[model samples]
Target: MPLTVNEIARLLKVRGVSQYGREPVSQLEHALQCAHLAEQAGASTALTVAALLHDLGHLLAAERDNRADDDLSCDDLHQYIALPFLRGLLPDAVLEPIRLHVDAKRYLCHAEAGYWDNLSPASKRSLELQGGVFTAFEADQFLQLSFSNDALKLRRWDDLAKVPGLRTPPLAWYTDQLAQVALPDNQAVYQRLRMLLC
Candidate 1:
């Protein structure tokens, strides 16, 4: 079953206290900062929600194993892990960007001059794990996705969100935005069941 917003929130609250990979901030703090950046940029509600939940896969992974060891070689593939959990709950506008944000990083590394130099050490390590910089063909392909621009925007915010003590709106502040972009519970459940039966 797909998790409800409350369920996801509870999971985040429990698991997001771990360090965000090697970053100084916790996962929840990074998320809040990213969402704050997106909101400050005047993103749509869907994009804002996407920013808030983009790293949810990391939390889910930590739930399944100890994530405090500071190992960067595990290739958690976090970009893809949260999609099944969130598939029906959020619209494509939100989910697609979350799905592609990792690729967005790769895309930016190749497409933007000096972008790679600005990445944190942890992000640079993950970049190698995430296939390093994209080839020109790969960059072209990523840009073809419908939500590519949004993903890039989210990626930029992700890069800037690691400031350790940065103040941002609380997670509770985004609940309304989450609710606005989420699929109705019944509709989401029905969609999941239909997919299962198919």
Candidate 2:
């Protein structure tokens, strides 16, 4: 089932208390910081929400053990995991960016001179699991995506959001914004009915 705004908030408030992979901050802290950065930059509401939830897949990962998922032989692919879960609840504007934010990181490392150096140790390790830096052709292909630019911006915020003890808006603040963007309860049923009619 698609998560409600309250459910989303509860997940962040509860599961998010765990450390973010090996990062210095907790998952909730990183989420709030990224959303705060996006809002301060005057990004669109969808983008702000995307920033807030980009790493939700990590929290949603069932096998997550604070450090377990990070050490897996393969990439956790957290960017894509939550999409099916969030698909109908959020508009594509919000969902697409969340789906692409990790690629945005790979893109930056490939395209920018010193981006690799700036990554935290855990981030660097995860990068290898995330398919490492993109190849030249891959970078070009990634740029062709619709929300790739937004994903890039979100990636920058994600990188900077790891500061410990950094204060940002409360979870309620984003949940309020989320309520505005989330599909109304009836909208899903109406869409299903429409699909059945066709």
Q: Judged by TM-score, which candidate is best? A: 1
> All models: lDDT?
0.87, 0.88
Clashing pairs in 2: none
Model 2: per-residue lDDT, tens digit, 75-183?
7789999898788888999999999998999999999999999999988888888888999999999999999999999999999999999999899999899888888
Estimate the lDDT of model 2: 0.88
**TM agreement with the true structure for every prediction:** 0.91, 0.89
Supply candidate 1's per-residue lDDT for 3: 68
Candidate 1 residue runs with Cα over 4 Å from true position:
185-198
Residue 66 of model 1 has an lDDT of 64
Off by over 4 Å in 2: 63-73, 185-198
Local error of candidate 1 at residue 171 (angstroms): 1.0
lDDT for each residue of candidate 1 in 1-198, tens digit (9 for 90 to 100): 566778778876777777888889988899999999999999999999999999988888777676552568777888888899988778999989999999999999999999999888888988998899999999999989899999999999999999989998877888678877888876567667867998
lDDT, candidate 2, residue 23?
A: 84
TM-score, prediction 2: 0.89
Clash tally, candidates in order: 0, 0
